[model samples]
Target: MAIDEVLADLKQKIDEKLPKGTTISSVEFEGPQLVMYTENPWSFADNGNIVRNLAKTLRTRIVVRPDPKVLVPPEESVNKIVETVPVDSAIANYHFDPDVGEVIIEAEKPGLVIGKHGETLREITKKIGWTPKVVRAPPISSRTVKNIREFMKTNHKERKEILKTVGRKIHRECTSKDQWVRVTSLGGCKEVGRSCFLLSTPESCVMIDCGVNVGSEEHMTPYLYVPEVSPFSKLDAVVITHAHLDHQGLLPLLYRYGFEGPVYCTPPTRDLMALLQLDYIDVASKEGGRPPYSSADVREVLKHSIVLDYEEVTDIAPDIKLTFHNAGHILGSAISHFHIGDGLHNVVFTGDFKYEKTRLFDPAVNKFPRVESVVMESTYGGVNALQPSLQDAEGHMQQVIKNTLQNKGIVLIPAFAVGRSQEVMIVLEDAIRKGLIDNVPVYLDGMIWEATAIHATYPEYLNNDLRKLIFQKGENPFLSECFRPVDSNELRQEIISKREPCVILATSGMMNAGPVMEYFKAFAEDERNTLVFVGYQADGTLGRRIQKGWKEIPLKTGKGTEMIHMNMNVEIIDGFSGHSDRRQLMEYIRKMKPRPERVFTEHGDERSCIDLATSIHKKNKMETRALTNLETIRLV
Candidate 1:
């Protein structure tokens, strides 16, 4: 049915189901939900089956809100909430969105605020006309979380309008019934950076991941200029798989252009990606050049964003239903599952998935209700991509640090701020506790510290062991006292000049930019100092070049490019990556609940993609193929 028809049908149903003497003022679509303004909102509280029957009949979520005039003042409601909710809940923030009649309550212990069986929430809703939406704030107070909340509160009116606009677009009627689906790779197919792909059918157009190629300074972005998603005028929706720069870095560019569709993602991903997007702009501005989009574009993206929890099925387009599964990579990272058409097709895109368990998170989810064609990342898919055992890798890491410390030289570990950095933190913390290495002050950069803070917010998403240590055991390795944050570059310089024997974990794991480069430039000439890599360094990157034994390389300086000698010891410990290696990759396919019919590989070097595809086809005989950018595949 068309959007107008759906709305009319819902209105008629509401009229038929509402109790006598109850009147509705208006009805509208708020994204995927149906919100109705009724004078008899009390009846909804009294009748349980009324809403149950309506929701089942409409096959869409519904919310019955009170008329505008019935709401109590915000200040009065705040006092009531404070008096009603227990102090143990530790309410972090509370505000009322007048436009939506929602009382947003953020607390450290959301369970306490919810009471037993959500009695507290219902009490608040019944007392005041405003609905209570209790959210569990991150255990660690994150500046990124604060910034997003403030933005929404400050521009509630604008955010409301944006949601209404998106709701209409999602419910738009389909114009065709062609039961064929195809995928077009815009970028990140044959190589690892600038990852993007267009999933299109006769009824809808969706992009799985839209990100830029930061390593390629030459082609440092995705092919957004193509006619299909160009100007992004015809795009229905965009689903983000993770918060890494390669997966969600170029999202603002969509808003900067003309794409006004909603970006579906998990809550943790929304916050983490916002943090990265803001940091990207800050880095670009510091380099004396403008980024592709401005802060306004980013704000627009946030306003248009609709967060869905893992396994919570949501409709993104007329024909596409989305479900997020835990992708054991980072906080809020998810494997994107799109159930398209009326069971006509199902596609599972493992966006940078890690099939094996890590200290930070559980392994990526392999079971699904249905999967026909699977798009998997092949970062470590080559024959030689086998990783050393975790025990061996940790031992080697400790030995490297031990050697550097014994030489009275500082050690620098370059890691991606999101996943690798946190994983290494656990390794280092555990080593120190076990007395595997001498105790040293482990320095953390701003990005690492902030990213760790984001991780602390949602402990439930982490691995079983880590989550137990955090929520149940009350012992978070990330909060270890030995860890010191390098708040500024001047502080970093001071630490180096002091020449103290310490370890530093910094960002841009590839040493592309950020605090990692600063530390690398300062320590590269020192033969005693060591640079350890615990993450993947893509091709065309400085880290890759150094790993390939580049004695010296030219780097951009304030005045001109200067050659930086690589005298410091550079070592790579292979098992600490968040992405699955060759062994884990094959095991993931082998253990899939219902194995996929066809597999396409991307997000790796050309050789890895081909090698992995060949192995899968030869072993499983699943009609696997290696894909490249701009390649199109039809699945019917």
Candidate 2:
């Protein structure tokens, strides 16, 4: 059936299902949800079966809001809300938005304000014609969260329009279904960055992880111009698996090019991506490079973005449903699972996943409810890419720090501010607590401090032990007294000049840009100093070049491209990486749940991707392939 025919039928069914005298002013889509604007909302909101039956008939989620004409005045609604709530809620602040017909309530304890079974919320809506949206205040005030909220508050009108426009596009009719699903590798194949996969069925088109390659100076972005992705209107949604620049950096460019659909991701992924996107723009400007998008473009992403927790089944495209599972790579990093065409295809994409638990998160969810084919990452898929045990790695790090501190030499660790920096902080804190390493000043540069604060805000997403340490015992490694934030370049340089034997963790993890480059320049000539890498360094990056034993490096500096000698000790701790090692990658496949029938590998160097693919094919006798960029695979 055509889209118009389907919607017409759906509307008729909804009308029949709703009780008599229930006035529906409008019907629209909010993502996959069917939202009805009604003058007589009490007739629908009060009756549970009305919505349940409508949802079953329509085969989608349903939401009903009071029409703007019937909405109570904001001031009047606010007074009643204050009176209806109890004192325990500690309602920090709230406001009413006539457009969405909801009262946004920010409280210290949102659950307390909401009451049991949402009885109070239903009462409020019935009495005052305002829906209540309760949000908990951050345990520690976060400027990023505050700004995101303020942006939403100020743009209610704009956001409402965006939602309506998106809703219409999402529910638009499709006339064809070939009954076959094909995936086009736009990028992140035969390479480790610029990860994008274009998934298309006759029913809809969706893209996953539209990112940029920060390691490249020329071709830094995914192939969004490919015919499979171009004329962007057909692009239904973008599902970001993680917030790494290599995973979501080019997302704003979609908005800049007039792709106004939604971007689906976890809540932490939303905020963290915004932080990195804006920082990328700032870094580009300072380096005299032109970024593809601007701050405003990233803001557009936040406005259109929809956040779903792990395992949330959301209908992103007409024939597709998306579920995100913990990838154990980073906070909010996910393994993207797609269930397409009512069992026609079930595909899983391991977006840079780790199979083992770390100090930060549980391992990637291995037992999905359903999967027919899987796309896996091969970042450490080579036979020789084995990592030492975490205990040994931590012991080595302690020894390195102890030796460096005794030698009165600085220890510079270049890390991704989001995941690696926080893990290293916890490792150092543990070493100190265990009396294994001496107390030394730990300085955080780049975005580490702000990122650490963001990590603290999402304790529930972390591993059980870490969550217990934080929410249960009220202990957070991020708040350690030894860690100090570095705010000024002058102060950073001053510390370098003072010949301080401190441990400094800064970005970028691969040393393509950021304060890590500055620290490397200042300390590179001193053999007493050490540079330790706790993360993957993409090929052709400064980190890779340094790791390959470059005695001399040509760097773009204030003096305009100077050549510097590297006499410092360079060390790499493979065990500290967020990615699983070769052994873990193989084990990940070996322990598969109800073993997939086919597999495809990507997101690594040519050798690793091919090696892993060959192993999977031979070991399990499963149909598998090592895909390259622009390769398209048809799965029945």
Candidate 3:
């Protein structure tokens, strides 16, 4: 029976025995059963018998254990696994159930039976239709450490032979000595926006993260414009790093051009890109210009995506192995890793990464199997990009909010719809719950709320701490009752004009475009409201201009310049950035088990890449190449 029905049945029986004016204060699920606490005034005999009768009636085992916290599943009458896979020489013992599936292993050496990749056990389960678990065989007291060594030796030998067969098959399908694998970033070379990278191999071609140049162009176009359709026609996949437009805006245009392949991403990215692409179309339409692509085109693109897990290695082509790892930049953002040939020329591309753990996601994992070369980004490569500690950053944000609330003015945070918006919400929620700030309405005005919802769907991809905190403590920090998602324009205007102390988190953190611009234009002259920046503001963006002490900004409406005389405070918090800083990058390289022979740096300006290359060469005594777009470097 369902849990709700079981609870209802228990409630009905309890209410029949209780008198009027009595109340059941609590009903909780304890280990092995349900427990109900009441404010009744009587202690009746046969209470234990009544509870036993309730269990019988519900068809579920229930016991009133002393602690009331011991809940366990009811015992079954039969040994299910033995019925199918009988105790034979191949199997020492078997225990199986419908829910958890079957487990068969060797009594002496379970590790040897399972094989290194669990190939032996997994194959059995696949054939038998039951889940298999290899027992961790404990060492006998007589042998102790010696027994462990012997068992592991046997296990390694058996597992290696089994894996060798499987590896041979995989190798045959994914090796190309004559094939070419080259990635060129035509744009997004200097700054964080206009992210476009080209990947070409003999067997397949792909481009990951084709976004627009928000920092430079008045109207951003997809990076796919840089490559002709003939090159893209041979493409096998176009993987998006995340849903942020700079990472995913020009996806639909791929279909418009005539590229049709599986758009691989995590499930949350698939859902978020749907909403974001539609918004992109709407925004472009409102501007009375040629929109990038139609909504139907985006749907078509989404339909072809094959959502996979973080480390699932799948073949995009006959000779290409692709896997996604958590990048910790935004919800569903991934660092693409390619194991391309028999030589295992492993290549790791950090689409955008956060080396430090954040509220919702874990830091990027730097370990890989012999990474030949790394294509890294240096958005914050300049000496000025170094960030303060997380505590200091959060403290400044809290102070800004407190000061703005004291003045009874709204605080606007123009954050990116993905990572920045989520980080700000997490900090704000914690601050509010701890009574650090007054209870004020936190309005989510742009695509921020939708993005938050997407992040919630995939908690496993987040940091280990976040996963534990979410699952164990039952905390949904992003979906707190304090946040109000504003959708309608009328409601947004009403909230903005209320003259109350509140927080407004909008999209387009750069102030290049999106709802943040509208809020800034409305609140810039107030002198009471404060605009807090929680992310990097690229040069030429309104956020950057304001940060540089620009007194006035040219309005998009072309009316005139708007003077910012408002007491509007500007504060920047840096720990939330997704990229690793200079120190972190160097430390990561130093820790690699097998140091790379050659390191090529791209995704940053000419100066930053050269500086990084120079540093790596001087320190590690290795060849470091500062790569330029369209310039190909031969490996091997």
Best by TM-score: 1
Give lDDT tens digits, candidate 1, residues 81-151: 88888998899888887777788899988888888877787777777778789876876668998888888
Give the local distance difference test score of model 1: 0.86
TM-score per model over all chains: 0.95, 0.92, 0.71
| Clashes, model 3 | 8
Higher lDDT: candidate 1 or 3?
Answer: 1
Give one digit per residue, the lDDT tens place, for model 2 in 1-636.
Answer: 655676677777777777788768767776677788888766665776888787777778788888877777878887888788888778888878777788899886676777887777877787788778888777666778889889988987887787767666666665574688999999899789999998889878899998898778676787788888888877889999999989999999998997988999999999899999999989999889898899999999999988899987888876788999999999899999999987888999999888998988899887888889999999998879999988888888999999988898999999999999998999998888888877878999999988887887777789999988875676877788888889898888788789888899999999988998888888999999999999998889899999999998999878788999999999897798989988898888888896899999999899999999998888889998888898789987
Off by over 4 Å in 3: 1-180, 218-231, 558-567
| Candidate 1 TM-score, C-alpha based | 0.95
162 in model 3: Cα distance from truth in Å? 33
TM-score of predicted structure 3: 0.71
For model 3, how does the per-residue alpha-carbon lDDT over 182-296 read when each residue is reduced to its tens digit?
7666556654566766666655566777787656665355444454325555666777877777778887888887865567787667767777778878877876667878987
Ranking by TM-score: 1, 2, 3
The true-structure Cα RMSD of candidate 3 reads 19.4
Name the weakest run of 10 consecutive residues (lDDT summed) in model 1.
Answer: 39-48
Q: Residue 421's C-alpha lDDT in candidate 3?
A: 82
Candidate 2: pairs in clash: 3-173
